[model samples]
Target: MRGKRDIERELIHAEAKIESLQTLLESAQTDRQELKSQVTKLQDALVAARAPEAYRDQQIAKEEENRTPRDQAQIDKNRLIQKTTEGYMHALERPMDVDDLDALLARSSMHDIKGPPSLHGNDES
Candidate 1:
């Protein structure tokens, strides 16, 4: 019963509606992907923020475990040297006076003359 022109008009309208829906679907899909990306980033940030001190310590211990024994010994030696240097710096806060320098030299001379104690308790040289 519908005329040809009426059917053509209806078909054109239907096609337009289908195209609009397709565009909306595409937009929704794009938005969904963006939201998923944002959620992943947020999850990563949350994990980083909530990381415990124990976790960090475990990571450090794991790294130390991976180091060679020689490397660990070298690190220990360096730390000891640094500690000794810091102790010396803390103890000698002020510059030594002439009398202090003289005393230090006297002590050194005494030690040199005494030559270190005899290991076998015999002074025979």
Candidate 2:
């Protein structure tokens, strides 16, 4: 009789453990669903923030379709003007004139004046 009572007690303990585990599994499943819903809401918000609206997209398409050769010619003209401006800027940056060249060379190696610079071919002596 004592053995039978011990077996009955163990059986009750095992059933209680199974019930606790089932309750824990249900809670975990509920938490997983809530997390999935939160993730979906966050993804939708991110998409709306990053994507352009349909009206802006249509305006860009219409503008592209309406562009003419005149617009292309204007773009070419602006490019030419920019190239010419860069050339002018480069030219201005260098010593082009003879006096400018003389001044540049003189400044580069300039020292305390000892005597006049030697003139090789232009000497009258």
Candidate 3:
């Protein structure tokens, strides 16, 4: 009889242990799910934080690339304009000497020979 009682008590103890183990498994699963959620949230936050900075960096690089050619073209245009202005101003500032004027007239006379000058009053210089 005592042996039978001992056997029954052992069976009960085994059943209690099984229940405790099941509870522990459920708690562990809940903890694992919570940890997974936390990790996902952290990943999303990190991406969101970095996205704008990455985009801004890319935009800045593109702007710098685009600016180089435009700035160079502007500089070239300014140089060309400055050179043209200087040439025009130099021409206006200097009077041509008679020798230089004669040279110019002789060069022009060659082209003028192709067309007759109108004789209306035109012994016209």
Candidate 4:
């Protein structure tokens, strides 16, 4: 008879726990719905903020006016060409010696220095 009463008490405790869990589940669902509503409202606000104004055309026109100088510079360059006489400017130059070349390379921070030629893969010329 004592064992039967203990089991009855444990059954009541389990039922109380299940009721508490059910209440928590309902509260969580309500919170989820509120968060979803807030997210929708924020998305709508972002869409409105991103919409172009009525003066957008005028703004674009002003920007195009400001870009005239860059456009003119491009057009000026397109009409210009190098003269053929410029070709002989370096025709008589000779390769520099190691010391002079090294000095120039040091001045340039060695940014343009190339790797040494490979000797291991020269089966042909």
Q: How does model 4 fare in lDDT?
A: 0.59
Model 4, span 1-125: residue lDDT tens: 99999999999999999999999999999999999999987865665577654245445555756765566666454333111122222322656555544454444433355535342223433
What lDDT does candidate 3 reach at residue 9? 100
Candidate 1 has its poorest 10 consecutive residues by lDDT at 108-117
Candidate 1 residues 21-122, lDDT tens each?
Answer: 999999999999999999987865665578865556456666767976666678877556655555456547878665554444354423244333353245
Q: Write the per-residue lDDT of candidate 2 for residues 27-120, one digit (tens) a residue.
A: 9999999999999878656655777454455555567568764677776775566555555566579757745544444543232333333422
Give RMSD to native, each candidate: 14.5, 21.1, 21.8, 22.7
* TM-scores of all predicted structures: 0.41, 0.40, 0.40, 0.40
Candidate 2 Cα errors over 4 Å, as ranges? 52-125
Please list the C-alpha lDDT of all candidates, in the order they appear: 0.66, 0.64, 0.66, 0.59
For model 3, the superposed segments whose C-alpha errors exceed 4 Å read 53-125
* Candidates, ranked, TM-score: 1, 3, 4, 2
* lDDT for residue 20 in candidate 2, whole number 0-100: 99
Candidate 4 stretches greater than 4 Å from native: 52-125
Task: Name the Cα RMSD for model 1.
Answer: 14.5
C-alpha RMSD in Å of predicted model 4 compared with the true structure: 22.7
